[model samples]
Target: MELFGQSGNFVLINIVSGNIDFDLRDDNPAPCENIWVGNSSTAPTDGECI
Candidate 1:
């Protein structure tokens, strides 16, 4: 686990919502989602995003 990093793509579990989250898309950096929903592959971040 890395979170909200400047590079790399990976998924981590969000225990609060019981979903997986990612901070990279298409190999680019993205806002790390601490809370998410939906499938792990396409998990979507919801309220209180960071």
Candidate 2:
């Protein structure tokens, strides 16, 4: 799956899996302001994409 759009916010629920991975990319490659990833019950405090 992929996401493409302008600035906005979103929430995901019951997204359970093993060894999940996230990648953020842009055609112009602008700096990413913020991103959050975690388990189904709680939010992640810290993580790195690259």
lDDT of 2 by residue, 13-47 (tens): 33533433433322222354234344352223223
Clashing pairs in 2: none
TM-score, candidate number 2: 0.22
Runs with alpha carbons beyond 4 Å of true place in candidate 2: 1-3, 10-15, 18-30, 40-50
Please give the range of 10 consecutive residues that has the lowest summed lDDT in model 1.
24-33
lDDT of 1 by residue, 1-50 (tens): 33344333333453433346643223233454332333233455332323
How many clashing residue pairs appear in each of the predictions shown? 0, 0
Give the candidate number with the greatest TM-score: 2
Task: List where candidate 1 sits over 4 angstroms from the true fold.
Answer: 1-5, 17-50
Best by lDDT: 1
